[model samples]
Target: MIVRVFGFSVIVSLSALAVAFLYRGWTGLALCAILGILEVSLSFDNAVINATVLERMSRFWQQMFLTVGIVIAVFGMRLLFPLAIVWITGGLAPVEAFRLAMNPPPDGADHFADGRPSYEAILLAAHPQIAAFGGMFLLLLFLNFVLGNRGLTWLSWIERPLGQLGRLDQLAVVIALVILVVAAEYLTPDSTRATVLISGILGAVTYLLVDGLSSLFQRRQPGGPDTSSVPGPPDGDCADRTDMQHGEIRSGEPARARHRPAPIAAAVGKAGFFLFLYLEVLDASFSFDGVIGAFAITPDPILIALGLGFIGAIFVRSITIYLVRQGTLGQYRYLEHGAHWAIGALAVILLVSIRVEINEVVTGLIGVAFIGASLASSVRANRRDGRHAHHEAVRTH
Candidate 1:
């Protein structure tokens, strides 16, 4: 399965390269390599989070994610999204915009050297705000997922009123509205206020729409059997318990020990669709910063598309595999906590980017630090548990 997936990805990637080459030779290939790496580096945490969601899905859904999801992400979000922003804000014709993107100005020349603004400059201008909104919204989503339990305690007041809505989808809309107001009042000047407001509103609304659709589908589906197909303790248990003479079998046993009959495959299918949708949203959130950031490196639309799209697709696939083979999420619970927190921080960074440029390197470093720390903590926990297991065995013998 893994080989087939990779083979398919390579084919798709090569095909894209062929098209790019047909349009513009070495320049396109160079763009592909650069953006592919950028997307991978920036979205490392995204892959981890995606893996967490994907693990719950069936094999068929996973395949769908690799194929269809890649197309939408590469074309719709990575390519069309930036183009749409240029069209709406700069008043550029779509074909002309594509032309400008395919043909950037000479090195060191201002993108707007010609009477009109360059496609690259328009693309760059779009990032700061994208970062601001996307970063913040993702942070909020991550917080709700990770610290949602805390609402039962410290944040009861906020959670209580909001909880009345009984659906996170509704809350998403409210948050999007608030962002729109902020963009209008404070983010942009009077002349471009409408553009800023519309963009902000669109960002928030897009997030809510995609995420809400995913959740609705998820709710309609039946959960599959709680398969013990995965090895180890039902999360949160120490490994030592498995070795004891207690009724429970050891951790190494086939997970089938814990398996019950699964729900109907049709139910799994529905659940799978929702899961796929959720992964797509997560990918969008993760990619937004990187996509926007790409403008900083170069304004050429083709370059941005080639770079971001190629890397984004590869990262998505790699993340899926990592999640499946390594079980990173199950193995390192704190990873999720760290990722959520990083996403929250990124949100703040995104919002700030509207007014002030936040470096991509800084953003990447911050996210890596959080996730790395969480991973270290998980390793420590695992080691501690292992020692405890050894001690118990000695005492028992």
Candidate 2:
């Protein structure tokens, strides 16, 4: 499974290295390698979150994530998205934007020979909107997880109370908006406040629309949204343990429904489309920080896309599948919780970064810390459960 998943990453890495070397010799290759590593470090939590969503998707959609989805992620978000932003905001034609990106003027030096702003300058100027949009989107994702009513609690002290608050409708939305407003009005520069606010509002609205559509499609499913299939801690508390075990798909749906594979397949196809859309948007949100941060290393759009977009994106998708295949979420139940916690922190960091720059290394460290702690905790829990089961068996005998 490891080879099956990561073989592509290896190939992509080699290809990126070669492309970089050919483009500008060893220095370019070195930059590409660094960017690739940076992307992987930054996006590890993204892989975890993707796993949570992908686990619930159909096999066909899962395949799409590997195939067509990678293409969209690499080219669409990494390449075209930045160019489009430059085109729209800088009032440059797409071709002109691409040219500027490919051949940016040196820092404090003019290569364009024209007074036009370089790609990096324009992109950096648009940082407020990018930060606002990505931060709010991620903030909502984190709130939805904590504010959800799932019975299991890794951080029982805090999560239990938050889960209680889940009884209130639109709690996540309200909190997200409040944060957005605070960031825009108080945290951001006055000149960019309006842009930040609008972008943040749009981010929150986009989340609502996508989540609502996903829920709507889920309900339209033959069996409806199988809450059991949600990829986190089991649905019920430790006491009322009657629910399906983690990772078990409910099996009691009508066999006749199964027999009519065509309609059922059609329904699944429709459902998967929305889920796929959600995944892509989620991917975009995850990449926004990395994309913005990549400018710190090199503003060469081609290099960013080659290394971060292709190599890093492929590896993340592979890791998502690997986690699912290993049943890591079920095995280490707190992993998903930890990933969401990291996401929450990242969201805050992204927002704060609008005012003050935060190092990408710091962001990566926070996520790895959370996930690492969760893995250690999971190991201890497994040992404890094993011992308890052994004790119970001996007592019964």
**Candidate that scores best on lDDT:** 2
lDDT of 2 at 214: 69
lDDT of 2 by residue, 292-332 (tens): 88988888888999888878898899999999778777677
Estimate the TM-score for candidate 2.
0.90
Per-residue CA lDDT of model 1 for 3-61, tens digit only, reads: 65466656666766776677668776766677777677767777766765666567788
Where model 1 places Cα greater than 4 Å from the true spot, the runs are 1-31, 111-114, 150-202, 205-209, 224-267
RMSD of each: 6.8, 5.5
> What do the candidate models score in CA lDDT, each in turn?
0.61, 0.79
Q: Which 10 successive residues of model 1 have the least lDDT summed?
A: 227-236
lDDT of 1: 0.61
lDDT accuracy of residue 28 in candidate 2:
92
Off by over 4 Å in 2: 107-115, 226-267
Q: Pick the candidate with the highest TM-score.
A: 2
lDDT of 1 at 131: 59
